[model samples]
Target: MRELIKEAIVDLKRNDGFIYVTAEGKKIDLHEAAARGIAVTPVNPKDQVIKKLESAGLHLTDNKFVADLNELISVLNGGGSSKSAGKRRSFSDDEKSKILEEWQKVEAAGKKTKAAFAREIGVGYQTFINWLRG
Candidate 1:
């Protein structure tokens, strides 16, 4: 693939799963490089080309980016690096019982179901289900 990119895309080399080209002493992605009329395979499908360019930019597909960024900020703020940015919230015993009671009433009445209860309580349905299991 590297050889193919080098041969087909002028001045661009495959680096860390991204084809990069040096322009004005800074590295740029193959797409931008191609936009500058540098060679990348034009005949190939776009999705295939994008897959080849995977994990190279600010595009984080996983949901952990905000947590990771928050942790970084916490570190920068002189807090312990081992700390979490409120990943979980605990309900008081009273609150838990209230929620469970309301949930049971809804279930018994065949009314607003699990999802509706979760929404009312501002929690995900899976979390509400877990609460029921406990």
Candidate 2:
């Protein structure tokens, strides 16, 4: 049964969805496998880490484990605090004016729309629009 579960997990990972065939050539979906007590679930990295820790006899409620888990979760969630996540880049008025001026030249060339020009220059379309408004 454990081997069957592992085989199912491998099959699911190899494919986009869960599909398995038994030794007797019986095709089964994930729900059917679950009903038969195969117990297949989607692979989650966080859950896998926790399971590994538990299997290694580490208590999830321990202070050190909890702290480490929190840190790991933060990193998985795109870094922890706002400071570590970094700040939004600030552009000076002069820089904005220069970019807008360049945009005007591109606009005159008629090769690209404002949004396309903004993308080509690596600026957000809405940010470029805001610069134009100013």
Candidate 3:
């Protein structure tokens, strides 16, 4: 297959369009590259395959709106990142000692681990461990 593709690239002899060099060292025709798999849509207007692949899910996503303001108000409270959902802001040492003192009681209860207590208190796992070590 590697030898076959190398031979095909040598035979094709044009570098003007989207040339997909695969993991197997196979160089595919743009149409063949799209047909095989993956979502890399390359566009050079002078390249003949541009118009066809442009229709194949790449350029369309560029114009996509993820959500409207109405959706934000209806569901999320102004829609901050979902990735930061459980995480909270940082706090100072006096505030931390206060949190950790309370956190120790929660640990005494033995239901929450130090890591979970850290999440509730808004410090990182290492920072919480460092606080405990101190």
Candidate 4:
């Protein structure tokens, strides 16, 4: 893993427009790195909050962090029933390609059915069809 990280850093350096090391220290342009697929990630507020808490000698597992947040909500609501949170899912380009490949395999079989393909890929039938259209 260390060697892979080192290789990635070297590759990033080769793409001179994105990364730079100044007289003071190293600097990285996140936008440029993301555009080049070198370091693509969503901005996670939970991670930022965890970092702040860690400095104060507080450590939290992901589940514990979520439970604490839920408890805070319960307190704010004066012990009212808390609503369950629902998260929207997203897929990366690689994952989309893999799904498409799976769909193609299903199509190559004797029976070609979108619903079956969607079910196998853990997506709604309509959504799978839309992906194929795209």
lDDT of each structure?
0.63, 0.67, 0.60, 0.61
lDDT of 4 by residue, 22-125 (tens): 33433445666556556333323344445545565445556776687777779788884344345345788899998898778778884768887678667788
Candidate number of the best TM-score: 4
What shift in Å separates residue 78 of candidate 1 from its native position after superposition?
A: 31
For model 3, the local distance difference test gives: 0.60
- Model 4, position 102, has a per-residue lDDT of 75
lDDT of 3 by residue, 40-100 (tens): 4443433323333344422322333223334445456765655446866567889878987
Looking at candidate 3, what is the lDDT of residue 118? Answer: 79
lDDT of model 2, residue 12? 42
TM-scores of the candidates are 0.34, 0.35, 0.33, 0.37
Which digits, one per residue and each the tens of the lDDT, describe model 2 over residues 1-87? 455446435654655443454555455566677788764445443344455456666557588877766777887997765433555
Give the Cα-based TM-score of candidate 1 against the true structure.
Answer: 0.34
Please say which candidate is ahead in lDDT: 1 or 2. 2
Q: Each candidate: how many clashes?
A: 1, 0, 0, 0
The sequence of per-residue lDDT tens digits that candidate 1 reaches over residues 1-134 is 56534543543333444444353434466667778876443223333344444534322344477577677788889896565445565788789889999888889999897898798888888988888899
Worst 10 residues of 4 by lDDT: 17-26
Candidates' RMSD to native? 14.2, 14.8, 15.7, 18.2
| Candidate 3 residue spans exceeding 4 A from truth | 1-90
Candidate 2 least-lDDT 10 residues: 40-49
